[model samples]
Target: MSALVIQTMQPDFVESFHQALDAVARERRYLSMLEAPPLERLRDFVADLKHGNNPQFVAFDGARVVGWCDIRRHDREIHAHRGVLGMGIIDGYRGAGLGKRLIETTLAASWEIGLHRVELDAHADNTRAIRLYESVGFLREGVARDAVRIDGRFVDVIHMAILRG
Candidate 1:
């Protein structure tokens, strides 16, 4: 219950960050990963993210990463004005208002990086996450039926986006 600090991800923190992500992924709740990518591959990926224009933020409790969020911009010129968002928080930190901070920080960073449209998809069953996104101005655009398979069953995915005014 110490102060939580939010900052841009750095190369040196990739391993711990990956471990944190894997822990959340294994919970079988939000994300669909059974295990995260190997350390070497994830290290390179994080390095690449550092070089890209996309903005990523990590919330830390001292040295441990409790949450992470990022906006990955489309590469093509026609789609470059938009970005896709992804985020996850460790199990113990779910309802403490950390998720809101992460999303808000990412949205602000998205605008700062010149992105006008930001989109995200959440499992339709994930009401808490969908509510969080909506509270921050994201609107449901459509639903991709059976878009995710979790624990052997399909789940609808809700596509949501927020356009800069």
Candidate 2:
């Protein structure tokens, strides 16, 4: 309803972040889980991310978190060039191009931080997300068959990646 503010996730915003994540997870469409962690656990995790080298971004509508995008790079030296991506948008925000903005901003930050490749996995049925990733130069790497189990059913996951040029 207000102008979206895109920025890095801050420690002070943990509770709102957790609630946004939990709400998105319950949607059972974009994410793989049906539940999210409790507030304290999420706070500690957020604290660690804030202190770590990984790059994470959040879209805020005034005080509420509307979307999030994060990329966690590998720790081992040989794999440090690669980072895994994850993101979600609230129900009211889909199809309005917020996802495109978030992914582009996160990838730009990832490249700036020396990441060479950013990877992500999406539910095969999530065409909207797949299109968003593809529009940003992500290529279909492969598919992990039945990689997610939800609502007593298994779903395929499409693995995609974008390599920095």
Candidate 3:
């Protein structure tokens, strides 16, 4: 596997990022919640990065986008020290360590921006994602029962978080 180049996302990369995310969403049944935001929304999301409110990163394999992660700081004053994280990788790129790199890079960026903790939620049945989060030091916080309805079936969500030291 080629080494993934982890870097901050740029506005120009939005289309490719959306494409990669769409591919992942289609292949990973549990990631159906991942959706491509409209171009305007994506532009706004990218703009948020400039103000240090939303931090986004992309993993590239020689110019092709393979994975992406976003860590957005909470807007609530009481929760300002924390951020919510979201990640997705192309199906063909799984198990290649790209996810780990993407996550670690995002976490590092979060820490650099003064966030004390980062949280993420994944479908309970997504064992692969759970293991990846665990490997990166994110502890399972709790489960939200019947949190999401997918294809007429209810799926639980596992809340996980990692604190920066």
Question: lDDT value for candidate 3?
Answer: 0.85
* lDDT values, one for every candidate: 0.89, 0.89, 0.85
| lDDT for each residue of candidate 3 in 85-111, tens digit (9 for 90 to 100) | 988988778887888988988899899
Candidates ranked by lDDT, best first?
2, 1, 3
Off by over 4 Å in 2: none
By summed lDDT, the worst window of 10 consecutive residues in model 2 runs over: 45-54
Candidate 1 lDDT tens digits, 8-33 = 99987787789888998887767756
Who is ahead in TM-score, 1 or 3?
Answer: 1
Clashes of 3: 0
Error of 3 at 101 (Å): 0.6
Cand. 3 TM to true fold: 0.92
Native-to-model Cα distance after best TM-score fit, residue 110 in candidate 3, in Å: 0.6
For model 2, state the Cα shift of residue 47 in Å: 2.2
